[model samples]
Target: MALISDNDPIYELLDKWHEDDEYEKILEKVDEIPMEERSNKLWFRKISALNNLKRYDEAREEIAKLSPRCTETADIGRLFYMMGYIYDQKNCEFKAIECYRRRAEIDPSWDECDEWVNDSLGYAKKDMDRAYNAFSRFFPDYAEKNQNAAEKKTVEEPDILPYISAMGSSFMSSNLGVKLPLDQPFFKCSEEDKPKVVSFLTDRMHITDLKSLQQDFGRNRLAPLTSNILHIIETGEEPPLDKLNAQQLTHYEASKLLLGKMKEFIPEGGLAAWDYSDMLAIARFMYSVDMLTNTEIMQTYLFANDECKRLFKSWEEFTHSLTIGAFYNAFTRDTSYNINQSAKFAINVGLFCMQTYPGIEWLGEIKE
Candidate 1:
């Protein structure tokens, strides 16, 4: 009552508020408080509260008043942080981003704050809700960097002949019009196992020729499975499907990819494709396709260290062995890739080839 003094100069400012709307009165009382005092934090907090209360105009006015003082003080820095939080708390994500940016400009070390702000913007972009899930990989810079590494590595990989010399083909078809990729490794392995396969791919296989293979044979389909299933299979006598949380999803994805790749070679009604209902059939188709196109590869081939090349070469012969191998697994007994995961992997490679290379003849090959 004393602060709302009967003779204070700002007293009328409060009286005028008695007849104004209740929220407006509260906001006015908030205005009468001194900007510089022990209560500076309190003042800014009220301003943030006002902004959340939908008094954005009032909030801007308060910000304008503080911007000069807010030039570099830790107090001002904290106020901006609250301002950003207010925006985010209100679900005004862009406004939140703007606040975070403002804070970052005030202090670049505010990058920690920037991470979340950009993340919010990524989610709040709200343009493609159905594709919003894919936006989870919002680390766009990371993807670009990885892809650039892949391109450079593709170019540096060694020649194709030495590696192919190691690959087993029954009889030579000279002028082999077949197209095999020079860069993409053909062994059937999951991406988790890719690091282990990298030695083989770089030393003996090629990634650059991926584009060429798709040109000759067809394109690869991308059925991206989320979990890593390769480790379990290599260590266990039987393929371990149940150990993974996403085993079922990975299984289905492998099936989809295998089937999708086969569709490229056989099209919709092709007799050869129809013959392969089980994963083994699909796997064989992939191997046959690789054999047919082995000579046409265009990318640089890597000479695997003798041991690694030998392993990959032996892989080609026994690659067919894993079909009955995976089929015996409890999860794959009825599943498609059970017959031969390697063959299925080959088909996936074909799909990857197609997607990466873009087949000119593969137009309209995907089934409706």
Candidate 2:
């Protein structure tokens, strides 16, 4: 058989085989690769295959050969640790302990072997629970709540569950190409501003490409002057604008000043936790660019289309507003990557809220 290297198509096929748990095919791919190009990763895969098939002796022999040859200290440490697991599984307690100690000595940070060392004789109920409930990391707080519920111990819940739930729901809707409910408080805009926000999003600012973005907002629209103003707003300091002549005020500067002026008209608490200029910047960026096409995706907006028209007041206008501006506030407020996973996270938040506040019917309306 002709020997192949890492660049060969066989690697992809081997990856597929590994994913499918086809241990035999994995060994076959390993065999096809030349010995010179067969890195420690491939060798580990081969050992893993042997162990999966219960060929303990063969696995040990291969590990023995590979151990001395491994140049990377990390590889040697992991290799010995895995070998320890194999021995432990085989009921060779002494041999497993020896391997575990050797691995620890080689790599001081490899504390995972301590689990085996502490419970070498057998795992306790706590260890079993930890292993079984490894997925608790996804919903850290809720997982704790669930554990408390199981223990019949009451756990104090958080107050901002509705906001978290809404955020999570919106996030999921974004990924699944589904639109969130438009009637949510996060999307509260006046009837007069509705048409303007919708038109700005669907027609004027519905940017799908770089060309359109640059065309609508010039390439240097977010100039240093705008940055200066943003810095002042952020730091609560007045900039020395009088030093600059009228001719020095560029379009970007004027736009930023207008944004600052617009802040004065915003209703009390309407722009809670966010300045008008900041929201304006977010809105401009979101409406003027499509995240899927942009190389650097800062935010992903959940767009509303005809399918979800019934959920809105003026279906067409509300649909566009929901797609364009409504989410700008929420996505900007949320520190999550996007609305999908955030929305999924809301499931736990909503549940936690319901448990804490038993009678609030509106809090449970996170789905709508």
Give the candidate number with the greatest TM-score.
Answer: 2
- Summed backbone clashes in each candidate are 25, 7
What TM value does model 1 have?
A: 0.25
Q: Tell me how many residue pairs clash in candidate 2.
A: 7
C-alpha local distance difference test of each model: 0.36, 0.44
Q: Using alpha carbons, what is the TM-score of model 2?
A: 0.31
What lDDT score is found at residue 303 in candidate 1? 18
Best by lDDT: 2
Q: Per-prediction RMSD in angstroms? A: 20.6, 25.5
Worst 10 residues of 1 by lDDT: 220-229
Each prediction's TM-score versus the true structure: 0.25, 0.31
